[model samples]
Target: MYGQGMSLRFGVLGLLAEEPLHGYEVKTRFEEMLGGTWKVNIGSVYQVLQRLERDGLVEATGDRGDRGRQAYRATVAGISGLTEWLEDPDSQPQLLREDFYVRLLLLGRQPNGHLARLLDRQRRVYLQRMRDLADQEKIARERGRPQVALLFKGGQLHTEAELKFLDAVVDEMGKE
Candidate 1:
């Protein structure tokens, strides 16, 4: 995966591409979208939004409510920037979280049944994630963000590959 900062920036742009929203709304939507797997700090979201606005990638629309909350929308340049990033083929190679690999390594010593169960659980999770990605891609397509759809399609491919790999592992365990 990309660095947290880059991922967070992409996420903010993605949200704004859907609709203009206040800072809090952005954070809330992000959490909701990630299913709480990601926890973004308010300060970090605000800082990125400020930088984006400064770079003219995004613009502050106007204040909302009596408390004067500022709302942000993605500028045309922002959408173009996101599309460029998505199309760039030079993305850093994904770095698997070492902790999960370590756990898998340790678990490899266990009986085949245990490994089979683990792989089964992983396959299910990957399939569900792929379904979610497909749904998101459809939404992006409907919104005229073909770039976002492409990104989501990549994610779907990754999930499908994982599911295939897990299935192989489960089969190997059965043979053992």
Candidate 2:
């Protein structure tokens, strides 16, 4: 399941499209699929499953595990929703106002804000992330995982763009 403001509702639905799974199994499998890059909380998964069920996108199979946990599967509406979501390729505008942008905007509003220091710290963090992603990309390539490598490459490009945007901001701030 997706976090607040995250546009990954389709992700949970997509997994359900394959087969039915309980909340715990959904959490485990989602975390496994992403490796260590992301952590999907069990609570969030359950909440999303509940919401899906309420929306008629999924339904309880009435099949329970040995522990009495119920399993859920995608419905026809879920499949249709997933397909429609996947086919619509436009970026969600809400995502553009990420925390980093809010941080920068707030910092700019403060007359005595240590903008340079903040930018320097953020740059270091971004550089470290870029390094980590590069390492992952190399490992994925060595393991002959083209799909994984492609995902990493996309992340790398995004980080690179962020770095460039940061530099431009720093330059403009220097002139002020």
Candidate 3:
């Protein structure tokens, strides 16, 4: 399915709300928005679109696209739903099944030195991620995508926070 469930539904709805597009095109546009950070399968895109259409959030535009592909657009209700979702806060940081958390949990069962090495490696990776995000943010701003730039900035902050958490773990674990 989608990388982030529920969120992808709203993203698809928001894209359709902006303009009508075929399912494939919607997938392409959504990837473009995230600058290819997230990828949803074609089948998943159609599934989300189908669910949204069934939920009355979107409708067929009755317009055929290139090669007769069906196009979809957000309905009035879809626009309202999208707006509501935009204004609503996200529920996250539950830490359930998060990759890093799972890794840390499983790796903790291993021999002592494994976790220490992992923490050091992970810290370096996060630092590099921060640098990469700063570069990405600059390019996004230069491309007149302030929103995209903000997304990169958000990623940078998240990475930094994760690094801080790792540091705390290392401090308590004492390189053991």
* lDDT, residue 127, candidate 2: 95
Off by over 4 Å in 3: 1-4, 94-96
49-150: candidate 3 lDDT, tens digit per residue: 999999999999899976899999999999998888788666564556678778887888987687778888889999999999999999999999999999
Q: Which ten residues in a row have the lowest lDDT in candidate 2?
A: 1-10
Best-first order by lDDT: 3, 2, 1
The number of residue pairs in model 1 that clash at the backbone is 0
Return the lDDT, model 1, position 17. Answer: 87
Best by lDDT: 3
Could you give me the TM-score of model 3 versus the true structure?
0.88
Off by over 4 Å in 1: 1-5, 9-40, 47-92, 98-100, 171-176
Give candidate 3's root-mean-square deviation (CA, Å). Answer: 2.9
Name the 10 consecutive residues with the lowest summed lDDT in model 1: 92-101
> Mind giving the per-residue lDDT tens digits that candidate 2 earns over 37-146?
77877788888898889999999999999999999999999999888877765654454677888888888888885777778899998899899899998988898877
Distance (Å) between predicted and true CA of 76, model 3?
2.3
TM-score of each: 0.54, 0.85, 0.88
Per-prediction tally of clashes: 0, 0, 0
